[model samples]
Target: MKKKHHRVALFAATGVAALLAPAALRAQESGAIQLEQIDVSGGPAQARTAGATAEKGAVGPIDARQLLPADLQTFAGSASRVSSQDLANQRPLTTHDALRNVPGAATVSDDGYGRHSGISLRGSPFRRSRKVLVMEDGVPINFSTYLDAGTHYTPPMDRLESIDVLKGPLVNYGPLNNHGVVNFRNLSPFGPKETVFSAGVGSTEGADQRVNNTRHAHTRQTFDNVGVVLSYSGLNAGGSWDAERLGYDDFYGALGIRGDNQDLTVSGGYFRQRDRYDEDNFSGTLADFKKYRHDKKRAAEAGHFPVSCGRCYEWNTYNADYFRAQVAHNLHIDSKTTLSTRIYGNHHDRARFYVSDDSDNPPSDFVMEGRDRLYRNYGADSRIEFADLPLFGGVTHTVQAGLRYEEHFFDNKNRLGSTNERLDFGNRGSLDGKQKLTAQSFAGFAQTAIQITPTFSVVPGVRLERYKISFRDFDEPGNDGHSTYVQALPMLSFAWEVAPTTTLYGGYHRGLSPHIVRDVLDTDTGYIAPKKEIGDNLQIGVRTKAVRGLTFDGAYFHSDIRNYQFGEAFQSNLGDRVFSSLDKARFDGVELSARLDSRAFTNSPWNVYGEGVYTFVNSKIVRGTADGGVNVAGNEVPESMKHTANLTLGVEHDSGLDASLSWTYRGSFYTDALNLPMNPLDVEEGKVKGVWLLSARASYKVTKELTAWVSGQNLTNEFYVSDRSDGAKPGVGRTVMGGLTLKFH
Candidate 1:
């Protein structure tokens, strides 16, 4: 039944695209629309070309209005961008690797492929990146941003054109924007004809002798007014421990049509993964980490490396299937007015098979338990931009307004089975629990940039959001519950051009985050619907390029968070997670990013460059209650690292040879609100020690069509623990990968 429903939604999205193409073709007969001119700061000139028409006299075309500005320097917010060149130089193995350069982002890897990882920003706790808003080409990607905003899937780095991180006053984004927003810009379908293929393989240092392979193929072509793009990325890898493996496949395609005054783009993708890498089975205690930190062979022999039990690895598994489709259209009403609209839908299915491991049960005991979860959503967003408006004397205003509608559906079921049975609905044992949840939202926002003076601007925006959430428990009819929420979020910002090459910016915004469905409405004793999370955020930043060969950016920010949420692990059964609401917290931080190239000062063939990102934050609970009814008002928030930094140095020659090295550091942080020094029994309450990793990459262009590269991560072979949410999860050891790419027209 679920598969049938998925096909219907997929077909419906495709049908919408099919209908829009004919209308776009008919618009070709209309008169040409006057083009508007705007200057873009950096990156490729035709970065976002699918739904955009080239301006008459602009440096580059405008973005699709995906919340952030095309010119990052003029925006009155703190923003960080990673370009295609950076990706090429780094040769990252996962999405987290590509995001290492972004300041204020704390990335934790629980799986070798980054399929299950954590990304925390500001003072947000790192748990599958629930606090951050993640998007792909301006569309929200989380299964349910309001009900359950957890990261289950992230687009492979192979298909990304660029990455943008935005902070401060994001009125155009959503309820999960309390920390910030991360956007992955996809490659444009309307590009020059070309085909590219790459393949790579690597091995990590361990007694298990695990190896991993990666492959990617991308091709695109333009035929007059029509263009099409197709791409695929695949990965097969070994996990961090013995008897575990991971594999995934991703497929994507796009069709674009261009008219005289309008453009339309339709894109779709399917991703699937099956793995035996369960965090519960992969994690161990602190004593186990210390014993096996350096020697995998001895630890394996001791039967305590992963766990004392021997049969845990064979029975744990995870699987996921995700599908998404989107249609985007842009209309040039006039030279100074335009409209952009996007309709998108996605379906995701996930299953995890796990079992109990205790002292009473034997290692070979077959009592299997699992959870099957399904999430689907459909949304439509439309916005209009009015540029170069003469609103008042000596003042020009650029106004933007938009409306959005979204509906989400989530279904979860718990089952128990024998060891011989698979995770099939009929084959799996009896159903222990069943739930169906839904969320519907209606939102509208408007923002205006008032250029009162040639070198100064002020932007004010507000968003009104209305949402309804429903929960139903099939097992227990009395547990059914529903709630409705209405919120008004406001934002104000200003940018002043202190110098021709420098800009000073500041912003203030009110943020909101709704409660997750399970925490608010569940079959638990003494259940109380917790208040929604709210925050008041303020930030001041500066961007400067006054130095001939350097660019610098710095920002200071503060956030007063109310009703902060924390996830407590191992509170009941082993590896189980429970969410609790704390009273209030405060976060203060400073972010810095800078880059310099020696070639800018010296006209030489070799360009020596350096880039760095550093962040310092202090997160403390001003008023809160910890577990056991303890008053922990002055404790530090869990997983709030005080300092994080990444630095890179590289040299590039005109002959297409480049080499770079990067060093990343993460500061120590507490694991619970009680601020315990250590707890050997639970192993989830303690201060996690800090660690540093070093990576290096070198590439050479052997010919016009062939390029080769090699990279190494964790060159020092550090023995460190990356996370302790469930238990002590060790970080990846030293790894070396090499690949070759062939490109041709």
Candidate 2:
């Protein structure tokens, strides 16, 4: 083994010398000239001759091009961008993998697949990602952005070109931006014409086996001034847990028309998913979990508990369909002025049929519960931007203002039936409960960038929002109610260039999250209402490229939340949770991100690169009472981990050989505001232990048009508890996969 290691090192050194010798000699013969920086935003700025709007209105306000590693100092706030090249190099199996290394972002709910998991930002709670604003192509994607705000669907990874994470004082994309925003950018239809296909398959090695398959195709073309794009992605897999099956397919299309001074784009897509997974059997008591971690079906047998027999447990299933459409138009009215508008609509239908045995006693008959839900949403936004306008005393200003209107409706129904019945359409049980919610909102915002001097700028903005929501409970007519609210939120941010490659930036904003329909008027108590969340957020950060081949970004943030909300689960049953609020809560933290590349220092064929992110948060409930009227003051906030970190190190050669090894760590946190210790029953109110995972991937370009790759996750085969929403649940075990890609023009 020692001799083999030495030989490998010698071979790498020889290859590096052979590839760098000519470049080194050329630099000596003539003065070295660096290449011009490439714009990485992949937005209109790259494809259009007219100067694109800095904040491109409804399409997206933040420009990702300023987030390049070498140009981080140009951005005015804490932000990061994962480019198309980064995604191709990572080849992530789930969205968690793709976002693991981003500062201030955390994935708490894995769900084995990335489809419906939670993505938390900063100090927000990670359950269902309720506190973060998620967008795709600059449009909201939550189940009901104004009524429910629970994310249930996400676009497939194969169809995306990049992801942008913007943190701190989000004044342009509100209503739910208490923490920050995450935007998923689709591949532009205006890019070069090409066709690409990808296929892969793999399996896990363990007591419970899981098989995986993936296929995707994308095509783009243009004729004269018209451009078109079509894409599809499909997945079939045996999920992480036993007796679990998952499958989904996504289809998208886009058409673009470009004229001398204006452009129009129309895009739409459909996504369908079906999965057979026993929701009740996914978790169990602590003793049962430790003894039979992988044997979810047989866990109850250990305690001599009568368990649901063979087919009874397999009745649980989930089905969902999403239909979306949007139109965006940009008009260059003049050299320094532009107007943009976006209109979008979507319809989502989802149903879950799960076997339930929630009786307190040991023996009970299994019953099927069907939860059906539907949502419809429509919105239109328009904005105008004026750039480089002279105001007074040699001061220039860039101003942007917009107006938005939105309407949303949600319908939910619950039904119960015997397990022996044939659940054909999953909506066939007797109606037991029903609810309907509707909301309409109107908002306006204006922000101006005042260039006080050449090296410093100050941005001031304010948003006025008004919304009305109504809720109706069919089973209980007394629970019907309606409410209206209006808010004026203001923000201020500044950026100062202290050096050629260093920037100091900070901001302050007022954040708000309106009460959901159910929370606005609690059905459990006809007239009891929970207050909405209001927070005062402050942040300061620095970005520097002082080192030759390294870029570093660090920030400190603090948030004071009034009427902070949290949820608690029942100890004895599943699907029984309650939401409550505290008078005041506080969260303060620091986030650090750094990246290093050897290629930045020298023109070497074999380059080494490393990147990492670390976060530290201190959260506390200043004033609150538990369900039993216990004072919970000074206790740590639930689901707020104190520490989390991720690191990746890799090597790339000009020959198209790339490999990377990553390590991710998630710190321990409590499940309730009381910060209760572990109990034998293994209920949700307890401390969850921390865990670390290791993953490795390598890919080689066999030819110009073809590439091959393989990856392994959880390489240590670590068996650990992932989450405790209902009870202790096991994380994904070790898995390996390999794949190939083909591209042509």
Give the TM-score of each candidate.
0.90, 0.89
What is the TM-score (0 to 1) of candidate 1? 0.90
Clash number by candidate, in order = 0, 0
Report the C-alpha lDDT of model 2 over 1-745, residue by residue, as the tens digit. Answer: 3453344334333432332211100000111111122233643342311123332211123222111222345555677777778888998887777888888888864455667657878867777777877888778888776788877677888888777787756577777777887878776666677788999888654323356888999997778767788999998765545555677899999887766545567899999888765445334456666676556556544431224443444456778889998877655555555566667789999888866554233234556678888998877777666666778997877777777778888988887776445343545588879999888888888887777876787888898888887888898888987778888889888878889778888888888877556655655778444466888989999888988999888999999988888766444432455576878889999999998999998888999999899988898999998777889999988878888899999999999999999998877887778888866565334887788889999999999999998988788978776766655656767777889989887
Write the residue-wise lDDT of candidate 1 on 181-200 in tens digits.
88887766665677889998
Best by TM-score: 1
lDDT of each model, Cα atoms only? 0.74, 0.71
- Residue 56 lDDT (model 2): 25
On lDDT, the leading prediction is 1
TM-score of 2: 0.89
Query: Which residue pairs in model 2 clash with each other?
Result: none
Candidate 1 stretches with Cα past 4 Å from truth are 1-66, 207-209, 281-287, 294-308, 358-364, 419-429, 522-527, 571-575, 679-683
